[model samples]
Target: MNCEQIRELLAGYQDGELDGAQHEMVSGHLEECADCRAELAQLDKVKEVTGKVKYNDLPLEVWEGYWQGIYRRIERGLGWIFASVGAVIMLITGAYYLVKDYFMDPAVALFPKIGVGALIIGGGFLLVSVGRERIFAHNRDRYKEVQR
Candidate 1:
């Protein structure tokens, strides 16, 4: 097996999840690859230490307090998100009216100039949004492949 495939299977091999043949293959690879052997040794040490560590249970009041803090943070985060969305809506609405007024004014000789400026700004925003979406999609695809 290749080094990457061996690395990916290391966790399963350590956990005894691999079939006998696959386990043997990984073992063979580890015997030949110093880096993989080092990685496996490190993982084994981590697992051993973690397994030996003791966990403490929180008191009822402490649990409640922990949950309360989490709840408060979530509430604050949601409130901020809503407020940001409202602000964006207001800005867009106000800008729409301003643009409309600029274009409707009969004596304004700079209507075309203002319209062109608005168009350029709007186009730039659209391009940025599209670019961001494409980048997010590409990264998401890569993440899924890695998970597999």
Candidate 2:
């Protein structure tokens, strides 16, 4: 076989993947060609160096930081979720009582009831608008990572 063909199979031959005929052909070429022999030697050195490559590990602080970030995100997310749920439940109950007891009373004057209803509606809209704005700003806050 030519040097190029034999060199192509050199890795396979080194790993004992070549059949007897192929092995003998490569051996014959390596014996006669100094260039092929040099190539085989270089391949052997590369295989040795790569086989000895070791795995490196990150430092303790890196792992600690990773875990801390994860825990903080989970803790804050759950806290906010639980607090919002509780507040919503209380708001619903209070709203129900206000509507049933105050708004439904026949003795209540029309003007006062209309004023209170308008105040509650405006407050609800303001609360929703502020909450949405806060969430939008929080998501896009470019300087949130800046330390004081």
Best candidate per TM-score, number?
2
How many clashes in each candidate? 0, 0
Stretches > 4 Å off in candidate 1? 54-148
lDDT of 1 by residue, 67-87 (tens): 896897699679868986997
Top of the candidates by lDDT: 2
Error of 2 at 133 (Å): 1.2
Q: After superposition, how far is residue 38 of candidate 2 from its true place, in Å?
A: 62
Q: Pick out the ten consecutive residues of candidate 1 with the lowest summed lDDT.
A: 52-61
Judged by whole-model lDDT over C-alpha atoms, candidate 2 comes out at 0.86
lDDT score, candidate 1, position 122: 94
Q: How many angstroms is residue 53 displaced in model 2 relative to the true structure, after the best TM-score fit?
A: 27
